[model samples]
Target chain A: MYVIVSGAGSLGSALAASLVAAGHEVFVIDPDAALLARAQEDLGSVGRAGYASSVAVLTEAGAARAQIFVAVTPSDEENLAACQLAKRVLQTPRTVALANQPDNVRLFETVGVDAVVSKIDVLIANLAGSLPAHPLLKLMPVAAGSREVVGIKIPALSVAVGRAVREISLPYGSMVILVVSADGKVQTGQPDTVLQAEDEVIAVAPADAAETLWEALTELR
Target chain B: MNVIIAGAGRAGAALAARLAEGGHRVTVIDPDRRTFDALPRPRIDSGEITVIEGDGASNDVLEKAGIQEAGLFIAVAEQDVRNGLLAQKAKLIYRVKRVICSVKDEYLSAIYRGAGIETVNPAQMEIEQVMAMLGGV
Candidate 1:
């Protein structure tokens, strides 16, 4: 596969190196000559030293023929612009962007970028997972920023442990999808299904309402 | 009308001031608060013009500037790429009625214009004027 990676920043260079090692044709675009030269030497791929969002730069980087285009610039606007240019102008089959701001994940989608990965959101999720009091784990965003899939491990002292699924007053637009017992027995969430301690519940809810759902399910009295 | 102008640079600040003077509520966003010092103060006849110190390209900043209710959205950031993206977001995401951007890069201006956003490219306009004068057109 031919890939065009915009920005010779750490993320961009790493992606280019991995793609090159996989025997894929890769090209990197960066405005900084020093960074471009380093990326070219490290990844052994074509390097175009110019603004990635520029039509001339993209054309010179063979964006038209590239199967995939990924923008990993530090600026969300730059990433979005480069990806849009790749998709709209160059007609790249797939365009992905690393959204610097978590809020930009949906914005990137609205602008027609094929995919958006929010590193900050992932980092936040990881950080959230390390907190013992908050057992909610953000699985992934769904339906842009509107909804998300989340996992929560019910605590022993939690108010939800002894309650039925229907008894819990979950936030609006939140639904418990599935539950897994401590022994790893998976069960579909039903109104009559009683919650148990250590039960891992996977739920879908509006992204903004995830915390509310978490508090409802795991908050200890 | 509610107007949100991203970037408190010379062009953005000037546009914001003019719009505010016309009795349109204006909000200008920039990373540097000091940029607002260059803008004209609000007069008795002018509507409120708020200066926000934040990244113009940020969705939070745009929302804080009342982008959802904005009748006009303009991005005149120093970076053409930032302006293009912000203009697209204003039109597509926020559903602003009118979106305009100042793109210094002629190539980027063409792309933004093709995407249905109005773009003013000073460099392109200057080049065209120069060509017209030299060619006697």
Candidate 2:
């Protein structure tokens, strides 16, 4: 696959290296000539030193023939504009943008970018996972951002410790999909499945209802 | 009229001053408070012009700027992406009667226009002005 990567910064350079190592054709664009020179030397890919949103720069980078275009600039506007140019003008099949702000993810999607990766959201999720007493760990977002897969650890003193799956009243739009016992046994969640202490439950629920689901699973008797 | 301007830079400050002079309530938002220094001194002293230091792209900032009640929302931020996003939020989320943005890139201006938002392209406007000066149109 032919790929065009904008912004030749740390993230963009790293992605270009990986793509080149995978035997894919890679082209990198950046306004900094030094960064583009380094990317050319290290990744053995074509590099262009100019604004990625410029038609001349994109055409020189072979955007029209590239299968995928990725914009990883620090500026959300630049990234979005580059992706828009690549998608709308160059007719690239796929375009991805790195959203610096978490809130810009939805905006990027609404503007027709094929994918948006938000560093802020990733950092927040990592922070949530590192907390000592976080009851719910966000596994990943699914179903186009409407739902999320989460992991919950059932504490021994919780009210749900010995209750069957059917006995717990999950919040609207939430469901327990899998349960892994403390003894390393894995079972699909079913109406008759009984909860046990320290069992890790994996569930899917509406993104907004995750907290409600966690409280339901960890509430005290 | 209630107007919200999402940048306190040269263009935003000038527009806010003009609107305030016309007896319209103008609120200007920017992440840097120092940018407000560029705005002209308020003549009315009736608090017709307000300054807010916050990210215009944020919903909280927009709400605090009274975007829900704004009749006009203008995003003249330096970044095209931020302006486009804020304008979309004002039009789609806040349901403002009118939303417009200043775009440096002509292609981005076209994209914004295609998305049903109004855009002012300074670069294109400059070119048109030069053409008119040379008697080309």
Candidate 3:
């Protein structure tokens, strides 16, 4: 597969290296000559030192042949513009972006980027997971970001401590897939499977219902 | 009419003042506190125009600026993508009735305009003026 990568930042270089290692054709573009040269030398991918959003630069870089356009520029606007240009102008089949701000993931998706990964979202999820307070960890986005895979840990004071999966009114659109207890026992979530405090629940839920499901399982009642 | 103007640059501040002068409520939002100095002091002092120092693209900031009550949103940030994306977000999320963004690049401007948002390219507008000066060349 041919992949066009915009920006030669740490994330961009790592992605190019991985794609090259996977035997995919890679073309990297960036305005910074030093970064571009390093990425090109290390990854052996075609490199262009120019603005990612420039039509002339993108066209000259053979953007039309890109199977996927990965835009991880430091500037969110630049990333969005480059991905949009790749999708609209070059007809790239898929466009992925790294939103600098966690909030921009939704904007990027709504504006037609095929996928958006936010570094802040990941960091926040990791940080929130480390806290003692009940916080749902977003495992990943699925179903074009309309759905989310979440990990929730039932706390001791929660009302769901001893309730069966069917007994708890999980959010309307959420489904529990599996449960792992603190002592390392795993249980496939069935209607009869009762939840225990300190048990981690892995579930898929409509993104909008994730919070409600978290509250349902982890709320201190 | 309630208008939300993103980017407290000269254009945004001037536009906000003009709108507030016409008896319309105006809110100006920008991430930089220094840029707020450009705002019309009298309107800001009288509370006819509200000023907020926060990321104009953020939903919290926009809602705090009363985007729900806004009939129009104008994004004139230095970056075209910032202006266009914020404009789209404001329009789609808050259901703002009208949105206008300043896109410096003509190609990017066309792309945004094609997405059902109004875009004004200062460079393109300047070029048109220059062409008209040459007798419609």
Candidate 4:
């Protein structure tokens, strides 16, 4: 889908990366050159950037043809106006306005926006569940699921805990087994080495082969 | 007198209604159609106010909102980035006098001021108000 995003803040940048990774044509609208440059670098080959003030940004974003228009700027008012402009003026089919103020959601419904995403609400909802033990590992790209990266700690009781890479069949579709540190260091493509207890392994597998890989790697059911 | 407000949220509507009470033409652009109905009771009935639910960043909306002839342009959005963009367009492109932007973050507020846009921050104001009550001001 062709998408146009207004702003290049944390949320905007993350959303752009997520969508681009999903193979969508994304156009970013931001006036800050510094932020734009950072976004360009972060998004790399998957996306394009334009100054928010330029007529070319809107024209090239193909506002009329865009499948989704997102106004995720921090300002509730700016998001509303941008979304309104995209819909009522640019004739974009669907528009989502980010309503920062929970109380102002009523304004969203009353104002006729297609949808309103409440960041506060999302954070609140997430907190209701047991905060995942590995909070930093939250929200991996779903497409990455094709490769199916799984994190596991080797235990001393396991028979293969001290075995070398060539000693075990390992998991099915486990082409790459990377050891990531609690401190975030990564050692990839383990060719030959003794696996130690407490060592973390990130194994990748094809979608249908994850269970097989898990069983082969770990003794626990 | 014509006024163009870039955001259709509460503050923008309040300002529009206040301006309209003085008999100025007011147009507010917001993505939410509900903003039109969500406006304070007085602002909605002002008859002189026109609420166009859509983006203020769009040149078409800017033009339709009469940005060219606008006496004042106000951008009071929740996001500093959007407010700054609309301010730049209003001042540099449309040549509107008295471009007022509402910035929530002090860091962004400083940046917006450095970029030569007049800014008001409700969050800062509330903070200051609280501080004043506590004798911190």
Q: What TM-score does chain B alone reach in each candidate, compared with the true chain B? A: 0.85, 0.90, 0.90, 0.87
Estimate, for each residue in A97-164, the C-alpha lDDT of model 4 and write its tens digit.
78886644654555466998988777755563333322112213246566566666554344556677
lDDT of each residue in A1-221, candidate 1, tens digit only: 99999889888899899999999999998888999899999977788888788778889889999999999988787888788778877899999999987877887887678888999866765664566775579999999779999999897667898899999999999999999999989999999889998899999999999999999998764
Flag the better candidate by lDDT, 1 or 2: 2
For each candidate, how many residue pairs have backbone atoms clashing (under 3 Å)? 0, 0, 0, 26
Candidate 1's docking class is acceptable
Candidate 2 lDDT by residue in tens digits, B22-60: 889999999999998887665425688888898887777
lDDT of 1 by residue, B31-118 (tens): 9988988887644235388888997667778888899889998998888878887888788778898899988876667767776789
Model 1 bad stretches (over 4 Å): A125-221, B42-47, B128-137
Model 1 residue A45 CA deviation (Å) reads 2.4
Which portions of model 2 show Cα errors greater than 4 Å? A124-221, B43-45, B79-82, B130-137
RMSD of candidate 3 to the true fold? Answer: 11.2
Docking class of 3: acceptable
- By summed lDDT, the worst window of 10 consecutive residues in model 1 chain A runs over A122-131
DockQ numbers for every candidate? Answer: 0.48, 0.42, 0.41, 0.04
DockQ of 2: 0.42
lDDT to native, each model: 0.85, 0.86, 0.87, 0.70
* Tens-place lDDT digits, model 2, residues A4-29: 99988889999999999999999999
TM-score computed on alpha carbons, candidate 4: 0.40
